[model samples]
Target: MAIPRPGGGATQVLDRSARTPGRRETESALALAERMPRLILESRRVSSTLAHGIHGRRRAGPGESFWQFRPFVAGEAAARIDWRRSARDDRLYVREREWEATHNIWFWIDRSASMGFSSHLAQGPKVERALVLGFALADALVEGGERTGLLGLTRATASRRIVETMAQALVADDKGQDDDAPPPATPGRFDEAVLISDFLSPPEAVKASVDRLAGRGTRGHLVMIVDPVEETFPFSGQAVLHDLESKLSLNVGDAGAWGEAYRVRIAAHRDRLAEIARTQGWTLTIHRTDRPASEAALRLLTLVAAARGTG
Candidate 1:
């Protein structure tokens, strides 16, 4: 199945049909890399949908702090012309300000095994949604003059080259070396972080990861990507459940009988994550694959703007 065009309804799904032998049914990392162009385009398309929702940063250009005065060029805004400076010079003069650039905003995408699961009830794999959301947010962030990079794979940068760099990293990230834990190095105090993941790891593990960043004075945003089936647990009758990362298997007598308990556990897990965010003074937003990627991307940008005191 092909990825649905932007604005397509919830039923639209990402194609995961191609796979190498011995690999899971989900789209392999190589297949995903081959489709990077399409993914980036789709991400930009989704971002454009929400672009109108965000206002341009008022102080995005040169800093408001005064620097020097230069002769005003023709057709310049009258307000930009400094009357005091012009009075002392034969030509019109304009006040210039010191340039103030924003700090790097790091994005961490979870490539854990569970993130690759796409239930028949949902749109696509959690990882796909996360990548789209990350790229969409990166587009907006870069457009807004903020530098961005993947947390573990790349450093913060404002160069447009980082986009392709990130895509390459995402496609090559299927080696399974990294777990759901946070990156080892903490971000600088001035830098901001955005973490997108299914966050299916143990609650303690998740807390430890976030706490490590928090300890370093890093204020981050936690974006939880969820599959519709994961949240609803809609399976019924007898079914075998398998762990994506660990190959552990379980025989369920009746999935329906386990739904309520499963939901409760999931809800508790979410609550713990929320509490962790609160304790760290960070923000948390949950995005489901069944929903529009733009929704999450927009919210993530808003959080980024707010964190950087730009919005």
Candidate 2:
């Protein structure tokens, strides 16, 4: 199926062919920024599950709702030491409880060349959709007083003050290049992680990265943004296809002969991803680039709501 173009004057679809003439594509960063507040609000309405899960007002501070107890450390506050428990065990123990202040949300975006694919009928490319979604999510969580951080799989920083900085850096016109690499180890503990990608890489690689994030006890939400062309594998007649990340090319003279095989492969890929998400208890949502950003945002919100047990 083809992606539907965005209607109204809210978004402008850039012409990719124009990039070959040495003219720079006008930056839409400002336009995207301006739409962010509205998107965030809309996201909240759609994603009551996530909004309620993360933003629900809980009792202030480390209270008696059992997180864990640890051996008392030197210079620790005496008030935190559980005297009643200490008397029973004859060993000093400090009550460690879940605190609202420690909750942090980390957002990751994929900036690989594969993410630039967008059908003529679609509103924008995968990368652009991912950026807008990440921005809106971050803005919403931050607005709710949660500490938020941003990371491009190709770039990462953990500063609370620069939540949208990485996304802003990705505003350049699509060059169809794949120079960006995965980020180095990230600093600080993250409570939840949101990953936006096309996931063009092998399933094992994707699963490994996800496992690393999960190892940190971080709940994960993986948003797979794809172009209609990629999902449908629509290559009519003869065509030359290229792997954007590997820089490898394939020429096919008979599109009809390979259509069935291609569909099978795509189905297997999606099934594997779904199995991984199920096993890991992670939320996975797929958005087509041809869909309106508003539609994609609503779907994402629904996923979040489901995660929070609100759906």
Candidate 3:
């Protein structure tokens, strides 16, 4: 699953770092999730305020809006029994309600070596950012009364008991790392599939996985967390580049001469990603390692809101 680089080779890895016990990483992620309700509420309020002049109908709620009709089940609430429909069909049926413009948001993060890059001196690694964002998004979705879960390139779990399992997997030693871990198996009719990755994998592989999810009725949203160094090619003079995943090394001399070419290649890769996302009608956001999690969270929420509008 190597991505073809502009040079006569391919990019097998991006971030390379030893597995270290992340200090307060779990606590930080939990805290961020805890703050998600307030953040989402504020975002909604801000959006409403900003669009005050626009005339639009109020959105329907889960209780008020009728989604569909289902066969009446034993012990079901009598209030849910649709008498009118029963009179017409002469069959017992319950009225199915719809929730308020909400959808189940499943956060899938990539915890591969490429996600361990960090440019900010004081900031956590890209993997940490992915974890925090996933946690926060899941928390927000849950607060909205939408079912939420998390999945990673190396781990996937749905139970609240395993909510932090993905993060733990990231910090675990990869002495016997399994590269064949399958993509997260999603249930039928997923509302949204949010992927946080550097996308170091091949474009075809990534696209195929996304298409599979979309085929299952999951709307895809890709959040690409890239290191600033990777984006800018800031290395100077002669340098030895290492492949984080494969442990391969390349020596590059005269960084100045290669800087422009590297930047062009990176830009092309990004453009290709953007084009793919656009064609799939998926929200694609690029986050830098230097940006604050709060800023990234707001941007992610904006994407979610935009996707909701399209829905």
| Candidate maximizing TM-score | 1
lDDT at residue 19 of model 2 (Cα atoms)? 35
- The sequence of per-residue lDDT tens digits that candidate 2 reaches over residues 257-281 is 6665666776787677777676777
The best candidate by lDDT is 1
180-232: candidate 1 lDDT, tens digit per residue: 66578667766778888777776677788888888877888999888777677
User: Candidate 3 lDDT, tens digit per residue, 65-154?
Assistant: 867877765533466578988888768876655542234566666656545445443255566666666665554443333445554333
Give me the displacement of residue 43 in model 1, in angstroms: 0.9
Off by over 4 Å in 3: 1-58, 61-97, 100-103, 120-122, 152-184
A best-first ranking of the candidates according to their lDDT comes to 1, 3, 2
lDDT of 1: 0.68
Worst 10 residues of 1 by lDDT: 1-10
Q: Per model, how many backbone clashes are there?
A: 0, 2, 3
Ten-residue region with minimum lDDT total, candidate 2 = 2-11
Could you estimate the TM-score for every candidate? 0.77, 0.63, 0.65
Q: Give the Å error, residue 299, model 1.
A: 1.1
lDDT of each: 0.68, 0.54, 0.55
